[model samples]
Each structure stands twice: as structure tokens, then as C-alpha cells.
Target: MSHLAIIPLLLPLFTGIFLLLLREQRIYIKRTISGLSSIALIAVSTQLLCAVSDGNILVYSLSNWPAPFGIVLMADRLAALMVLTTSLLALFSLIYAMSGTDRQGRQFHILFQLQLFGLNGAFLTADLFNLFVFFEVLLLASYSLLLHGGGRKRIRSGLHFVVINVVGSSLFLFAVGILYGILGTLNMADLAVKVAHVSPENIGLVKTAGLLLFVVFALKAALLPLYLWLPTAYSQTSAPAAALFAIMTKVGAYSILRVYSLIFGNEAGPLANLLDGWLLGMALTTIIIGSFGLLGSKRLRQQVAYLVVISAGTLLTGFSLNSQAGIAAGLYYLPHTTFATAALFLLADLIVQRRDQMEDKLEAGLVITKQKFLGVMFFVLAIIASGLPPLSGFLGKFMLLRAALEHPALPYIMAIVLVNGLLTVIAMARTGALFFFAAHAVDTATNTYIKQSEPEPLKVRELLPILSLLGLCVLMTLWAGPINSYSLETANQLLDTPAYIDAVLGKEAQ
Candidate 1:
């Protein structure tokens, strides 16, 4: 019954409602409210992380009914960790949004809060139906945010985003409905209970439902074939919007993590044996397709978008491995990707802003010729994106590779890893050289920012958010040890479902 369990969702929900009233008021007031709300969320998430780090599952029942009939919010180590990441990223994006003024401020902040609420709810929820409810809330806000400013590019891409997700939601609902029919419950923990006695043959129903549900999650996570909507939808939107979308896909990954490990693992289920064959095959195919897309793409934005496909594939690889080590690597890498990719996209937004200033023709090489600081940040991000050595990105890849090296076809597996690594490096290197070389060659961009370099040159406030995000990238690389250890714990908890089930229920069997 701790109040801390729900603050992540509540703060954003309250801020969103309040922001609606301030729609026509002063921007400062709206900014103040948004900033305050984000700060509040960060405080609460931090408190929960501290409180729950000792491996406690904080469960809250909605309206106090009980298991099968009641709605519940469950916060374990993994959920709390995700809440912390979501809160931090949201705070940075909100602060960035507030510092830069625009016509979209009110609408932007409102949708932003709504998105947080959706994410928090998804992470915290214990019921299957409730997860879908939160999913819709998250995507609905995303649709509006993507379409903000009503640009033609945004409009087309937003429609694609909307149509694809709508179909996903429909599929999610069908899965939920079928599960309810079979088990007579929508609560995840309760399903885990009733599933043990549900006759071996009827388990076919559960496995089928699992496949259908995986499709929906994969669509949202942007796995191969189903991920076509992500690139244009992402590239067409503004930086702030892209920052938020990056975290959103992680929610889908989280759902996949939860479902595979809990329902289909070695926890009294017929589906346990089937996970390797179906899931592993899908993961391998996703990697093959995603790596090809990464190799073929030339633009910075498109390259990153394809990498999301690759990350999704990585997630599936960990899932398909079906071992604690596999789960550990997947869990560790998932959040690392969330933070790294979010920061990278924010960096790219800054690059695009600067590049946009050049108007494609380069204005006689004046606009982009001499911005040294921007060049450094761009290269740093490129390295992070490529998953080269000594970065958090590399840590995840290394663990996955280590775990996979034991297979019979170890050489082929290593080659796949090698090829993917090379492709990422080459693609990122090419993008970096284009800008860094240009920056060094151009004498100066001082005169280009304005007709003349004034005494107090105007600050690029638009870049502050991007820099703040990039700063996080450096912090993650520096603090990789602590982060990876915690993620390891998260992965351990994910693979060992007994601890999770017990934490949610009573120790003495009530």
C-alpha cells in the first residue's frame, strides 16, 4: 500500500490534466508546471529504486479487491529500473523542450506527460488487459506528438505509425481475449498459478496465444518486416519526439521479456520446450534482416532506425537463448540500448539542426565549416552507436557473444557477430567523417551563424537538450560497471520467475 508505488504514473497524469488548462496561458507557467512534474517523477523513481534495490516487489491493488478480479500494479527490480530510466529521460527532454520556445509547447508538454503515464503504467501493471490499456495511452500520445506542427512529412509518417500500431493493438486485444477465455483471468501472476493445473493438451491454447502476443509485441518493438513504420515515423518527427519514441519501443521489449521468461519458461508449462524452436528461429531471422538493413542505409537517421531493428533482434536473441545468462545479457543490454540510443538520436537531432542551417547547398561552406564542439559530440555519439570497445554498447554485445560462443556452430555465430560489428563501425564511421572532416576544413562557422559574429553571440539553446542527452552518454560509459551489475541483477530476477511470483504473493502461501 505504499504511495511511492504509483507516483510515477500519478505525477504525469496530474501534470497532463493541469497542462490542458494552461494551454492558452503564459509559456513560463506551463514550463514551470512541466519542469516541476518531471522533477517530481525523478524524485519518486529514485526513492523507489533505493527502497526496492534489496529485491522487494511492491504491489498495489486498485480499489482493493484482490487477485483475479482486481487490477494491480507490480513493481519489481526490473520495473523500478525502467521507471528510473523513463523518468530521467523524460525530465531531460522536458527541460530541453521548455528552454526552446515554439508553437507546440502546450501540446508538446501535455502529450509528453501522457506518454510518461503510459510508460509507467505499462512497467508497473500486473494485469494483461491493463498492459494493453497503457499501451494504447502511450501510442495515442505518440501519434499526436508525431503529428505535432502538422508538417506534411510528419502527417504521412504519423499515419503510417498510427495504422501499424492500431493493427498491433487489435492483435493484442485478440490475444488478451483468448487468454481470458482459456484461463478465466487477466492477472499475470494468477495466470501463472492456474496454468500449472490446466491440462497438458489445453496448454496448446496458451502457446498459440503466446505466438499471437509475440507478433503484437514484435510489431511494437519494430522487429524485421513489421518495423517499416519506425524509420519514416522517427526521422520525420522533431528531436524531442524521437527521444520519447526510443524509450517507448523499450516498453514493448519489456513486455516480451516478461512474457517469455514468466509464462513460457521452465515454470510448470508445456510451452517451455517450444520457446527454443520458434523464438530462436525468429530471433536469428530478425538479426539477419536487420543487419542487412543497417548495412544498406546511408543516412544517419535511417541508419539508427535500422539499428533499432538490430537491437530488437538482440533482445530476441537473449530471449531465444532461454538460459539465465541469455536473460541477463538481454536485460542488461535492453536499458543500455534505451539510454544509448535515446542519447544518440538526440545527438543526431542536433546534427540535423546544424545541417539544416546549411540548406543542403552549404551556403558556400559557411554554416557548417568551423563548429568544432559539434564535431566532437557527433564523433562520440558515432562510437557509442557502433558498440565499439569500452562503451556500454560493447559490454552488452560482449556478454551476448560470450553466451553464444558455446553453441555447436560457434564459428558461424562468431562470424555473424564480427560482420554485424564491422557493418556498424563502417556505417557510423562514414557518417562521422562527412561532418568532422567538413568541420575541420571550414575556416569558421562564426560568420555563418549570423551575418557577423556579435560580442555576445546567440547561444544555440536548441542544442542544450541534445548536449544534456549526450552528456548522459558519457556518464553511461563511465559508470558502465555499476549499471551492468544492476542490470545483471535485473536479468537474474527475470530468469528466475519463482522469486518474482513469491514477492507478489505471500511467503507462507497466505
Candidate 2:
């Protein structure tokens, strides 16, 4: 059972190395290998999740060394669940890319595999320094993937994304250095124990380091004031890449949950509740900004990108409450948002491909082929993204809102969330009307401007991935009871930081 902890990290690392040796022309071989590896990852992550579901924490130490001294990987329910979610998203994204998008670059397969490797590593590692290492690995892969199709807009957005992250990475290193210098340890479990015992005089420095780390994570999570890069960058990227990048923001949310719950949590004395006011205020503002962005977006992809921001704000709002119920709701909301957002990205690309010359613009154009099928898909996704009833989105938001009622800031958070949902519905409805109904104007245009041709029908290969993602959202709605149960249990485990520490560092640490 302990050995299984390393398989998630190793699977992608070895596959990525193997892919580097293959030539660019061997597209079929590359696709086969990538697909099989992704399936294997899904299996491995599921097994790990089941193993940890019994409220057990599995730890694997490298080279026979242990605790605050050597590298370690820890898998608890939250980590395993996150890994499984990531694998599922990766598999579908890879399938979507194989429909001719992978040809835009020479080493798409290799970069994709490396991205998985980094994400898995970041989730599994129990050391802060190694977390930084994995972050860089993933960012490097994403930078290349962002510019894969090589358009001027993509390149320009990619450059901004890269520069901002580079600065974030530098801050990450500085924070880690400060902590290591003061505490003489980088292992999370050890740091948790050491931070509790820090002298009062030096505690200020510890708080500063912890807050700096939060800033770094906030940049990744696209928290307000640091989220300007996401809209342009995500809107301009290839569909498959944008779908996969959905999980990247969750990585930051996961980090915030882990670090705050374990290290600077109630056990840290002065550091406890350090993030409450700031995180909550910023989160509500983020929701408003995202909602306004969605309403003002002029392109289909850009609207979806803003939806991503809205999801982030919702998740962070739940997390900021810093209670078990709130965290559980956030956990339940995480996977639902991930699948829905990814599906929208793929669906947008399909819609764009079917248009004659308008190409995803929010204005009238030639009628799309497969109009009924696409209309149904768009409506279903809109409901899911906008938190309408009969879908998981509504259920998740209900949980969050119900949990928020117990907090002191209930009125503020609840009002913002409700308004955001209303704005989202309006934006989605207007966009759908423009895409499906406004095409009637084409018949009235002058003869010189007339351009008529039957749009291409949707392909099975392209449609499969979108349908799979939507099906997942429906499944989530059907199984909400069990999923929420697991999320609640996961939250219980996270709040009980002492058990996590003891599991990783033995009984003496507790």
C-alpha cells in the first residue's frame, strides 16, 4: 500500500522520458502510447483513492531515509481524490487533442506527459522545496503548450503568462529559503510541528513567510488582482490545452487548503486566522469581476475563460470560511467545476469550427450544421456552468451557500454568489441566442456579401470527448450523496492535522 504512493508520480515521469525519444512523424504511435498511459494513470489513481478512503494516510520515503531528512510522498483522501480528478481530465484532454490538434507542435506528447508528471508530483510530495520544483516543471510545460499553435496573440499572451509566473516562482523560493533558514526543515509535517514551537519574538518572521507563500499560490489560483493573465492566455490557447489547464488553478486551491489547515492552522497560535479577512474579501470581489467579464465578453472562448474565473472565486469563497462544512462544500464543487469548464472549452472549439466566417464571435453568422445537437449541448453546459437546477452545479452551490449561512459574513458572500449566478445565466442566454437564432439575418444580406455553404457535420472523434465530460457532470449530479459524503470525510481528515503529522513523522511528533 505504501509503495502505491509513488506510482502516480513515476507513471508520467517514465512515459514522458520514453516519448522524448520518438520522432515527430510517428503520430499514431505517440497517440497510442499516450492513451494507454493515461488509462493506466486513471487506474492507479483510483486504486490509491480506495486505499486512502478508509481514513488512512500512506507515506513513502525515498532511499531508506525518513521524516524531516529525506524526500517523502504522502497520500491521504484529499490528495488521492485530486490525483484521480487530474487523471480523468488529462485522459479526456489527450483524446480531444488527438483529433488533429497535436500536430501543431513537434513534441506535444512529450510536453503533455511532463505536465502530468509535474501535477502528480506536486500533489504527492510532502516537502516544500520539491513542491516548488514540481511547480516549475508544470509551468515550463504549460508555457510551451500555450504557444503550441504559434499565433501572434497566443505568443503575446504566453509571454505575459510566463513573466508573471517567473516572478511568482522567485517569491516561492525566497519564502522557502526563509522558512528553511529559520526552522532548519522543509518537510511539511516537520514544519507543522516546528512552527507550533517557534518563539514569540521570531513568530512574525514565520507569519511573513507563510503569507508570502500564500501570495505565490494566489498568483497561480488567479485570485483577484493577480488574475489578469488568465483571460487572454486561456482564450487564445488551443482547446485541448485550455481544457487541461482547468486543473492547474485547483492545484493552488489544494495548496491553500493543505498549507493553511496543517501548518498555519489553529495550531500556529498567532498565525491562525491570518488569511480570513483578506481571503474572504478578495474572493467576493473576484466573483463580481468575473461575472462582469462574462457579461462583457465578445467571443465564445473568452466567455468560457471568465467562467473559469467565476469557478475559482466560488471555490475560494467556500474555502475561505475555514470550517469543515465550508471546506467539504468546496471539495464537492471542485470536480464539478473542472469537468464543466473543460467541456465548455471543447464545445466552444466545435462551435467555432462549424461557423462559416464568424468563427466563435458573439454575433450573427451562417446557421451552424447539427444545430439541434449543438443547441442542446450549449444549453446543458450553460445550465451546468450557471448553477441551474437538475445539475451538479446547483447542488454544489447549494452546499456552499448552506454552509456559508453559519458564518458571520453570510449576507455578503450569499448576495455576491446569487448575483453572480444571475449574471452568468444572462450572459449564457444572450450568447446562445446570438449563436443559434441570429443567423436568420444571413438571408437578408446583399448579393455581393452572400456566402453560403453547408457547414461540416460533427465528427464522432471530436464529439466523444465533449459528451464524456458532460456525462461526468450528470453522473456527479446523480451521485451527489456519495460524493458529498467523501468530501465531508476528506474535510474531517484535513482539519485533524495532528493525525496527518503523526502518520508522516511517527507518534513522537504528535
lDDT of 1 by residue, 1-510 (tens): 886888888899999999998888887888789888888898999999988887777888779866657888888888998898898888776665564633564588888889999999999998899999999998899999888777888899998899889999898988898889988988887776666557776778777887888888878877766878987888777767776777877787788888777766677555664456566656666667777876776566767777777777777777667666676777777766776667666666656556654422212333344567766776776666677877767777788878776766456556766677788888777666665564432346353333422122225555666676667666767877787677677777777777766766555431
**Candidate 2, 169-264: lDDT as tens digits:** 999999999999999999999988889888888788888999999999988988898889999999999999999999998988889889988988
What C-alpha lDDT, on a 0 to 100 scale, does residue 403 get in candidate 1? 76
lDDT of each: 0.74, 0.91
TM-score of each candidate? 0.91, 0.98
Cα RMSD for candidates in order: 3.7, 1.3
Candidate 2: worst 10 consecutive residues by lDDT? Answer: 441-450
Best by lDDT: 2
